[model samples]
Each structure stands twice: as structure tokens, then as C-alpha cells.
Target: MTLSSENCSEFQYQVLQRSQTLDANCLLFLIILGKMLLNILTLKMRRKNIYQNFMECFCISLAFIDLLLLVNISVIFYSRDFVLLGMRFTKYHICLLTQIISCTYGFLHYPVFFITCIDYYLNFSKTIKLPCKWQKSFYFSTVILIWIFVLAYVLGDPAIYQSLKTQGTSPSQCSVYVSVQGYWFSFSMVIILFMAFVASWPDIYTLVQAIRITSYKNETILYFPFPSHSIYNINSKKALLPRFVICFLGTWSPFVLLQVIILLFKVQIPAYIELNIPWLFFVNSFLIATVYWCNCQKLTLQSIVLPRDPFVNWKCCFIPFTINNFEQIEKPISIIVC
Candidate 1:
């Protein structure tokens, strides 16, 4: 396991760093393993309906990437004498590969965001509905393009090359890597969400005062008990905005705090951990919230097409959104529909 070094200083550093490096490696390995298992189970359960949503399409590609990353890391760990062609495998190559893959994965958030934005905009604002087959193809194409573009850009960029090279020649701090783009992306999301939280504070307070829930579960959260009349009519625009805020705050406040600490102390999050199921689900919630906020006047459960979330039940934002209001909503829609 001895690596050739240019000086006594470098050699001594690697020796002392070995334990720390192994610890980081073990953590990284465990994380990827968990993600792989969760992803496989989710895909198995949702296989039939995966093509129905934009996030689900992204999950297909992410699951493949997760599988590849896990397999590569596993092979590098289990077989010390593993060799390919004429070259012997070593720790350095594996670390470099991990860094590169991570950096590439980090940059993909942008493309995914952009494409999803366009998809939502077209779907909500436009009258024509795209056929299911066409929608599938659209997501498939974007996922493929996202992989190709991110790989090409990251591999071609000199910054990533220099970063990995620098780490190779020294006692690298982390076995898994977080790219600049990934760090800032996480940072930016935290800030955006914080701003949203602040903006909705008054509304959230009002909503809390307006409704009384029996329990914390999704179905029970929105339920109003018999004969008890709360201040909220549940039909008011005041209730609409607050329900979204409460839902967003409830589901994501912890992640937002985690990101804040990450940004404050500068935690390096590996790709597999950073771009995960919970993170994606949060992003899905955020996107849906944004769309709902922007087009508040166009929300009717039956007329509008808000994707049914498996995790956060967003329809609670419109708890009383029944056929009774259908006639009224048809004339002039409000903020919390569909």
C-alpha cells in the first residue's frame, strides 16, 4: 500500500493520514451502499409508474449512476490486486475517479432544474397536454443529455483536473469529494429556502392559529374534527398560502438547518449523500411550491395538474378543495388548487 512520494515530508504525511483516510473511506462506502439499497427498493416499488413524473425520470438515471459508483468503489475495496489491462489498480486512481464522478454529478442540478422548470411551465401555463408517451421520451432525452453534457464538461474542465492532481500529491482530506458547484448549489438552495421561510412567517402563524389537527400523519394532519369550527374557512386565500408554508417548513426545516451548518463550517458532502432521495424529494416539494405560488390563481384540484407527491401530501394545502368550490373556482381560481 506504499505510494511513491517525492519527499520525506510527503511520505510521512501519508503514513500519519492513513487511519483518517480509511475512516473517511469507510463512511463513504457505507453511504453509497445505503443509497444503492434504498434506490433499488424504491425503483422496484414504483417501476410501473416511474415515467409519470419528471422527478421519477431523473431517479432512473440517478439510480444507474448510484449503481455504477457503488460497484466501482466496491471493486476497488475488495480486491487489492485488481488490475485492468497492463496497469495495476491503486487507491489514488479510485479516489480520482470518485472525485471526478462526484464533481460531474454535482453540476447536474442546474440542467435538471432548468428542464423541470420548462416542463412545469409548459404543462401549467399552456392549454395543450402532452401525451404520456411523448412526456416519457422528453424526460428520457433530457436525462441522457444531462449525463453526456455533465461528463463532458467536468472531464474537460482544467479546474477539476488540477484539484484532483493536487489531492493526489498530498494527504487528501476526504476520501469522497464535493465539487465547488455542488457546495454552492446546496448553499444557494439553503438561502432561497430561508428567504421563502421568512416571507411566509406571518402566514404560517395565522395558519397555525386557524386550523386544529388531530395528529401528525399526512391524512390526519389536514383533517378537521366534527362540528368544530376554526377561524379559517379553509376556503380563504389566507389559508392557501399558509398551508404551503407549513408543509414546506415542516418537511424541509431540518435539511435547511443541515445545509446552514454545512455552509457555515464548510462540510464536504459527497455526491451520493448530497444528491439523494430525501434531497430530491425536498427539491420536488420546493418546485411544486414554487409553481403553486407563482400561479396561485390557477389552482383547482380537478382542473389543474399538480403531480401527486408520494412523500409530502401537498393536496392538504387545499383541504376543503371539493366539488362544492368547483363552480366558484371555475369562474376565478385561487392560490391553493390541485
Candidate 2:
């Protein structure tokens, strides 16, 4: 078993290369799982009439595209064949393909955000909407054009080109491009979540004391006890904040933990996979919440309408406390059990 030094070095190299490839596969698998979960949640939470809004259209399209891309990647890995369209997709080529997607996705982040914001404004303000006949075509064209523009932009960008340039080239190594954007975004999100959790910590008990589920004729309703002198207001983020913290943390705590782990380990994830639907939704929720918080006065005056959230339903939280004369009050109420 006494081997030559050259042979031992070669064996070690093979082992290291295998490890790297395995790591890459595992990372890709995790991304696929996350996308699957997001797709399911989106569909479950989506309204039955999806065409009611452009945001839903965009959401469905993006989820489908992400799923399609991941499926394509999976097929290649499973078949162990890198050929497609009579062309070969070697390690570097596959990595390049994914990086292109990541870059394009990253670039479109702000555009999509602003577009959603505009969508909300128009819907809430009851202003400028396309005729029903033209709505679908209009939104479709917009989403398509946005994708085309971002893809073209990413391809032309010199920074992306520079990032794709390699340090070392070897058949055993799969080199993928990454950006500081992923790290910075993840780190910032972790900080924001931590702060939000801390700020909501003190108000948790007071929020709990003001609500209860009551059964009447076998139908249960989540009744929030809002007395004339009490603190919970229907319009304020103060009352909404704790419920958001509960639902948000309940649904996305695992993803937040993943971000924390990635940050701690300094994982260099490609921006393409890193900037996903969940992250975008997280940003969307935060932006909407910030707007509401800043306009608490307007909210109290009934000027601002709360936008519909695809993931977290703001409609679930309500108040109904100090009901001495229940017969005198005639208010619209929901019957939700537990």
C-alpha cells in the first residue's frame, strides 16, 4: 500500500473535486425546495379570481419561471447529460447560464417593487386602470418587456462580465459567479427582523389580553376586545404589529434562520437564486408596513386603505372588546373558528 507521492496527490485532488461538486448539488437542491415551498404558499394564499390584479399575474408568472428553470437544471443533473439543443452544457456553461439568470433577476428587483407599488396605488385610489378586455394583454406585455429589458441589460453590463471572468479553470471545478448584493441584502434583512422582534416583544402580552375566540351556535370568531378607553385601534399599526409579528415569524422563521446561518458562514450564494420570491415578498411586506406606520394619522382618518397582502392576511386581525350591551351593537363580524 506504499504509494508514490504523485498518485496520492492525484487521489486527494479527485476527492476534493467530488466534495465541491456534491456541495454545489446540495445547494441547488435547497434552492429548489425553497422555490417549491414558495410556489405552494403563493397558490394557497392566492385569491380564486387571480386575474383581479396585475400583481397576481406577475406573481404566478415569476413562480412558474423559477420552477421551470429549476426543473431544467434538475433534468441535466439527473440524466448526467449536459447536452441541450444539440449543444453541450459543460460545468462552466451551466454555471454561466445560472449566473445570467441571477443577474437578470437581481436587476429586476427594484423595477418589480415599484411596479407593485404603482399597482397598489391605482387599485386603492380607484384611478387609471386598463379596460377589462385589455387588462390581461397589457400586464402580460409589461411583464415580458421587463424580463427582456433586464436580461439584455445584464448581458451588456461590464461588471457582470468581469465577475464571470475566472481565477482558475479546471474540468474538475465548477465556477459560478456571485455578487456582494446577496450578502448585503441578507445581512440587512436579518438586522431588520431582529429589530422588529425586539420592538414587538414588550407589546405581546397587551395584544394578547385584548383578544379571544368565542363560539356561538357552533361558529367561533376571533374577537378582539376593544373598549372605549382601551389601546387597540383598528386603523393603527400598533394593533396590527403584533399580529404581523406572529404570522410573519410563524411562516418565515425558517427562512430567516437560513439567512442567519448563511451570513454567519459567509456563504457566497449567487444573486439569481438568492433574490427569490420569498425575499421579494418580505421586502414588499416591509415597504407596505412602513408606509402604514408613517401614515398612522391618515389611517385613523380613514384616508388610507390597507393594501392586500398575498402572504399575510391583514383582514384576520380585528377588535371587539367590552361588549356590555351586545344587542345594541350592530357591526359586521366574521365567523372564524380558532
Candidate 3:
């Protein structure tokens, strides 16, 4: 195919279109797989429930909504592409599905983010302690409140869904960025910012706690067997989560700041920069997975060993048992082996 100016323009457009389509499909699949894997970890962790079960459930629900949205996005992307390529797009059903997913995404995302915030906030405030029974109560109460707010906010504005359905004349035109939700979208954005703050709270708290613990103690042997300023280096390995957060924010901050710049300054973001947004999202997605991989050593251990465990109980599967004192046992002690 010899390229003319018109053909070149069209080919360029097609390439950009396909790139965006691939980005959407790939990102969604990654997120879906990540969510499923995380859920499996959560279920396994639910044995004695050392972690926040309520928060895990909320996270899972949010992932479900996201998965639904991703699938919708995938359908819309390809369906629209087919139409453009002179193929029949027989599915008005995809539009409805997309609408429903958008509404659900808009509805569910708020509560999940808020719940994540509240989960950390509760931790920050010391309103609940780890391994405490009252924590569940707090989680439920906060979740219920968030749900009530989401339901009321979503239902009260009938125009949001209507706008979403009508806003995109074609699949290429469809996006949350340019959606018909209009000014109200800003409100949800504020909520997302708040959630981000909440998510970072634990990291902040851990840092502060580290500082405090370092300040007051002298016998603290600072991470390794070697000696350094105890305050400067106590359990440095434990700084994983906070360090991960710092790195995450650092990596993704440019894209977020770009959004702020584009909105507040009302500047025309360059096409290259706009295209980079999806890649930035991809980077952020990887950061989250990396954080999980780095911080959750138990998860990594489980992944390596659990396949070989005779008992299929995911709970007991991760636990490695060791006996401290067994010198005077009359009968042979049977190990409670996994």
C-alpha cells in the first residue's frame, strides 16, 4: 500500500486507535487478575482475621465494579472499532452494559475509597486496635454510612446516568474524562483525593511511630546486628509499606499533577502527554502490585509452598510450625503439619 497524505493520516489514526484499545484491554485484564489474586489472599487471611476483613471485602467489591467497567470498556472499544472498520456492531446491548457499569463504578468507587480512608483513619486515630473484636463493628458502621451516602447521591441525580448514556455519540468519544456527568464529576474527584489521603495515612503514622520509637529508646539495636542511631534505623525492614507508598506517590504523582495542571490552568495538554496518561496508569497499577509483592512476604511464601500442601485449607497452608521445647514428652508428639 503506497501512502498518500490522506492514507497516512488515516493510518496514523488507526494506529493510535488500536494502541488505546490495547491499553484498555490489557489494563483491565491486569486489574482483573490482580483483584482475583488479592481476593484469594484475603480469603486465606480470614482464618483468624488478623487484618481488616471489612476493608478487604470493600476492596474486593470495588475491584468487582472496576472489572465490570473494564469489560464494558473493552466491549465498547472493539465494537466501535468494528463499526469504524466497516463491520456491523450489532450490540446496542454493550451501550446499556457500559452505562450500567459506569453508574456502578461511579456509585461503588466512592464507598470503597471512603472505606479505605476510614480503615486507615480508624487505625490512625487508634479507634480500633489490631486483633480487636470492636474493629468489625466500626468497619460495618462506616461501610453502611458510605453506602447510604453513595445511594442517596447517585439516586438523587437522575441526570448522571442519562447524561452518560447520551454523552458518547460513538465509542471513540466515550470516556469518564469527557462524560456528560459534567460538574458533578468534580465532586467525586474530591472524594478520590480524600481517599488518597486516607490511604497514605497509615504510612504517615508508621513514620511518626518510627520516629517516636527511635527518639525514646537507646537499647533498640536498629535493624541489623550492627549499631546505628536507633531512632534512625529501628526495624528498617518494617518501613516497607511506608517506603512503598512514598515510591508509589512519586511514580504516579506526575500524571495526577498533570491532571491538576490541565484543569486548573485550562491549558491544552499535548497529544503525546495525553497518550502517556494510559502508560502512567499502567505504571501506577504495577506499583500497587509491586508493593504487594515486596511487603507481603507471607503471600510470596504461600505462593511458593501452598501448591504442595496436602491439606487444602488455605488458612493453615501459610503457617509454618516450629517447636521450642519438646524434651520431656512421654509419647511422641505428632506435629500439626500442614
Tens-place lDDT per residue, model 3, 1-338, is 58899999999998997687557546545654564455455445433423554544454444455455556556755565455466455333344444444454345433454445445444433565655567666666666666567646644677865665564334464443222332233344434644555766765454434321111022211111111333322123333434434434434566556555555765542221122223223232333333243434434433422112111122111121111121222222232211
lDDT of 1: 0.66
Ordering by lDDT: 1, 2, 3
* Per-residue lDDT value at 329 in model 3: 20
Runs in model 1 with CA error above 4 Å? 1-24, 38-51, 85-87, 126-128, 165-176, 213-239, 321-338
Model 1: per-residue Cα lDDT over 176-265, one tens digit each: 666676676777777877776677677666555545443332234453222334354434455456677677777778877787888999
Which window of 10 residues has the lowest lDDT sum in candidate 2?
Answer: 318-327
Number of the predicted model whose TM-score against the real structure is largest: 1
Residue 281 CA error for candidate 1 (Å)? 1.1
Error of 3 at 188 (Å): 15
lDDT of 2 by residue, 1-338 (tens): 79899999999998998688657765776777687787778567644532345556666677777887777667655665466679765544445556667777767666776787776666555677678778778777888888888888877878766564442124344455565655666677689778877888767555556445454334343444455675656556676666666556655777778888988988877665666666766666666655555444445323332465655544334323223443244333543332
Clash count list over all predictions? 1, 4, 1
Better of 2 and 3 by lDDT: 2
Quantify all predictions' global Cα lDDT against the true fold. 0.66, 0.62, 0.42
